[model samples]
Target chain A: MLSRVLYVDIGKRSSWVVDKHDIFSKYLGGSGVASKLLLEEARPGIDPFSPEAPIIFSPGYLVGVFPCMVKAVAMFKSPLTKNLGESHAGGHFSSALRFAGYGALVVRGASEYPVAVKIKDDKVRVEMADSLWGLSPLDVERSLRESHYEGMQSVISCGKAGERLVCYSNVIVDRYHHFGRLGLGAVFGSKRLKAISILGTGEIPLESPLAVKEMYEKLNHEVVLSGKMSKYHDLGTSANMLELNELGALPTHNFKDSRFKGAEGISGEVMAESLLRRKISCPGCPIACIHLAGLRTDFAPEHEKGKKEVFSEEVLLPYNYEPMYALGSNLLLSEAKNLLRLIYHCEFLGLDAMMVGNILAWTTEAFEEGRITLDDTLIKPEWGSVEAYLQIINNIVDMKSPFYAKLAQGLLETSKRYGGREYAMIAGNNGMAGYITGYGSIVGALVGARHSHLSNSGYSIDQKTMNQPLSHEQISDFLIEQEDWLYALYSLGACYFCRGVYTKEAVCEALKTVGTEKTKEELMKMGKEIFHNLYKFKVREGFELAEQEPPKRVYQVQTPHGMLKAEEVKAIIKLYIKKREGEGLRLKPEEKALKELLR
Target chain B: MKKALRFHIDVLHPERCIGCYSCVYACSRHLFNTIDPSRVAVFVRLNGTIANPFSVIACRFCKSPECAFACPTKALQPLPEGGITLIASRCEGCKTFDCISACAIEALALDRRTKLPIICDRCGDCAKYCPHNIFRYEEMK
Candidate 1:
């Protein structure tokens, strides 16, 4: 009853609910449940855009039951990495699924026409979204909310970039949160799926009310009173911008420089003082880490007004370290308002800010080197110029030229054709994240399941070893240790920002109140199992660790320690592979046979 | 401190609300021993867009509660301590939730499963659990 899975077929326009107790009991929920469902629902070696490819949305067991456990996981074959497509988003989505009495929802088979799947408790309908197909994410959500459902609802939608099949497009959740890293939005587009709206009015049953209340109070007190999460509520993750820049770990101008001279202009402190309009949170989170900036844009174009020549309106856009680095320092657009404008445009187009920023940076350098011409870019790409970047954004979405179309494919493909592979600044075919710390950050991205910095947080380990020399073996050990434990926390669908609060013991205690008893040791073992499960799917799809090499640009930049050596990084990566395979984690013969049988 | 007669919850600072739903969760848990949005007395809503702050809806503890007057069977009664209390036996579980419409602030809502009005009894659980101190349970004379 606690682990019901809703299977929806878009081609058939039908849906059914099944009690997936075996999957939930073994894998738990969130990433674990979603990965298992993807394995069972997908055929090996099929194109990620294939209609039969499965998209699984799952909330962890502790979600909606424990404080700060607000994230939900999405798993599929990534159009970006061509491997495990795993992304986590924090919003009302997880709690919505919880209150709807389902642990996971899987969509299989593509629709011939654009559609929006609407769910109200037990009712599910695939409605025609003809009017909303071409709208932006914000417009799509507004249309669905105003015209379709009433009461509290959570909506996940894609926009024009996804419809164009841009490889790095993202799915926006509840207007602000997102499955931002991978190409889930493109996957939605490939299925002709515009949006999914959920309204959950069902009451969730508690195993023991008193036990839950006690644990909830304890966790809530730790989140609010302990002062651990106060920084997030005050300035959010953008607080890292100034600190990383000071440490020379912030990637600037496409990794040409490690620190930006104008970092203070767009720092979190300045944004909070001048641009911060409001702070919000996901449904159940008390920290309120989401910070929105108010950007006043002049809407009037050649209009005669009574008092002024221009009419302006203020718009709200969320800002954190990723966008701050991607649009601000990394692209050399240091002005806060300018960075916010670019972020708003990406949100409107449903493009991944980080990926687009990486692409733009690479193009700028190529243009400066005379490797690319104006005919290829349509606009002369330049660093620190918002106008040029904005024009490029328009071209990429419209696919104005062959070069622009290639740019929409992503960094790896764009660099391959454009002759800039050395400076592509990517790992595992995905654009490198905000961190450019050292070998740890680079190797972590290369080896990570989703090729994301948050996958292992190796950058933090690099920071810890800045003052002290750490062997490559020590770095590899630390990185794997972080990933294993983080896998467990992520399985609970808790926010990574709250990892400080949800220790292994804390996770164990919380799971018990929900009638699932898990010891710290068991939770850790489960983490390794889930990690292997993800690799199993990735390996089945022909993902190889040796094939994913960090771009040469990563080693060119000067980190806090010094310039990194390629040999040192390669040695660390080799050790990482040995450690991973030494754990006797090869795919079981029965599991492999089952996958083939499912196919 | 002065001894007071009527004690009820009051809004202190609406602007500081984060829309965490902790108060709603606490109220539901306190009343029904479960965390269900349908059974909650306090309602939280985002104001227009993410740019704007959140709004919290709770009983105003009106001296003459409109909810009490609109009930067909007089299931809702105004308590001496302020706010309305529901009489379970008198409640018809009717489809016509006139009490919900009669509330000026729209603080009252119907339980989706039970089809009965969820009236605030001024237990002050919402104020007790509010992390931002948006609510104040005061004794008014």
Candidate 2:
């Protein structure tokens, strides 16, 4: 019944909580609510790094209560696209913020000095963090742990890449989880906000405790007892290695080939058999899908311990298919340890692993093509060269070199500068997500709101397309409908992993427990409304529909089906723009208006 | 002399612990019908780093319970089988917070919002809900 929005003005070092009931109740939560806030608070022409531009973190409506509903969104105008920046992460962030008595947290205004904000229950403290400044998320965690950030606390911090204003820098949470795209970290750095620590002790009020318990048990049964959730439970999403490899849709060496020869080396089964040490989960998640891997390295023994004694030391890090694919197959780095080190470097520096992988892929191709030389990249980025990638990873965060400064802007901009725009393989200034699976994915990337694969769920459509091919109209219909459903689920704060659990019937039933009774039709309506609202925000922020173009590299690449035809890719993207513009009665007026303004 | 039976949360294989905090949620919901993991019977503190480390804070239910002895109001009564049975109604809030400081592992923490000490009820809900069997249920004679 109670939802509070905590607004912090860093320049003034002041904060306040406002009960924005109408906004929250309508939008529900997560990115939907945050998008509305961005519309209200963000000035249209202000720079993303300016004092007036705000960074908003909103927990989902069912965040503290619902099972598998874990992600919290950090929203802002993107420096990368200069349009919309919305990134999400899973950990204890949502639950912590909700239990701390706030539904949303907005950080506005740039601070004069480094600062870390602490939120414990109702009290918010803005403290100087000079000692903790300029450190990686991992190093900052050490300082935070020694202070009051122990025992049931979640921290969101930026690292060196962010401090250097890398366009694709991430806001890292709990080291492994991140709001991992589109320059939110730069916004944090520009504000001089180092980190946020939350300690929540209050219990969330449940409408019907018994009903909620019943739904949870059912969801748990679906998650644990069924084979549907087992892949995630066992090897995690990296199981896609063999499947995607067999699909011939594995993007290898900068989209040159859709298949990698060394696919088995970094496959989920091998990772589980060798490096997997633990399976961690976010709050209320029964699946425990996040696999923590152990990276073993030999180090010099102490003189007292003995000379010539080498011991293997294990450093544990968590990974999913996206990171593994981006850092492993795409870069042609087969060794597990090398992939782990590269990924850890990205994690430590607070760079989006997906974006980093894309840029690295492009950089390697550029080097091979002789467009950029060793002097520009500081290394000969040969295929399968982990050593070169390691050196370049350091340069990415440092951003001191001329080439590295261009790299910070992201693959699209950098490729344009270095003569590889055709092979850049990006959508809306964002990198591809380790999947060149099919036309659905490629088209979805181009046509998605804010150019995110997850936005339209084209990955699922890609799978569906493999079994049964669809017409351009059918694909467009699928994308629009899935987008609607996903928007609703995200608003409800339900994780997509539990898509099996939160079916239309299941979600409606679950809502009954939370004192909200709605037919599935009404839910779909809300989703459609959210879809329009997001487009409105993006359009007003100067996102031209024509700019969402399919790169030439996508057509050149091979997919599971065969060679993807240029006409097919172009037709799908064209139909997408058409349906979105001229169809759908509810949004036709706005779409017409947008068409007039843009055309 | 009769051999005594005891139960312990065998976290000897702490590496196996997924850091899920499922036990925490299970305990809190089963006990108070709430979702705050902090109010739960067990709390898992993840190092929150890319490099691994984590600690699950829970009462050991020791052979000799110091928290029980530290309570001036006799609010905490030691069970013969091990662990303490807390009588929440009988408790007058401890000024010294001796029960909290008495525990070697600091399993018992004070909820400053309510100014009340929180102690584990030795409810095995955590053991039941843990997906990985990280919390081994042990009965030793």
The model with the greatest lDDT is 1
Q: Compose the digit string of candidate 1's lDDT tens values, residues B6-112.
A: 56678878888877788888888887888787687887765544335667888888778999998898888886756677788889755688898999877888777
Error of 1 at B55 (Å): 2.7
Model 1 TM-score relative to the real fold: 0.95
Q: DockQ (C-alpha) of model 2?
A: 0.44
Candidate 1 chain A lowest-lDDT run of ten: A143-152
TM-score of the first chain of model 2: 0.95
The TM-score values for the models, in the order shown, are 0.95, 0.92
lDDT of 2 at A245: 82
lDDT of each: 0.84, 0.78
Residue pairs whose backbone atoms clash in candidate 1: none
The true-versus-predicted C-alpha distance at residue A271 of model 2, in Å, is 1.9
Please give fnat for model 1.
0.54
* Residue range A1-599, candidate 1, lDDT tens digits: 36899999998999999998999898788888887888898889878899998999998777777778888999988898777889899877888888888899999889989999999889999998888897888876666653322244788898888888888899988888898877999999999999998878776678799999999989988898898888888888899899999999999988989999999989999999999987778877888898888889765555745433357788787899988898889988889989988999999989899888888899999999888899999899889899999999989988999998988888777877878899897888787888888778888998888889998898888888887777988988988887888888887888988988887788888888878888888887888888888888887887767556788887788998788888888888888888888986543344555787899
Top TM-score model? 1
Candidate 2 per-residue C-alpha lDDT over A178-218 given as tens digits, one digit per residue, 9 for 90 to 100: 88888888888888888998877777778678888888777
lDDT of 2 at A175: 66
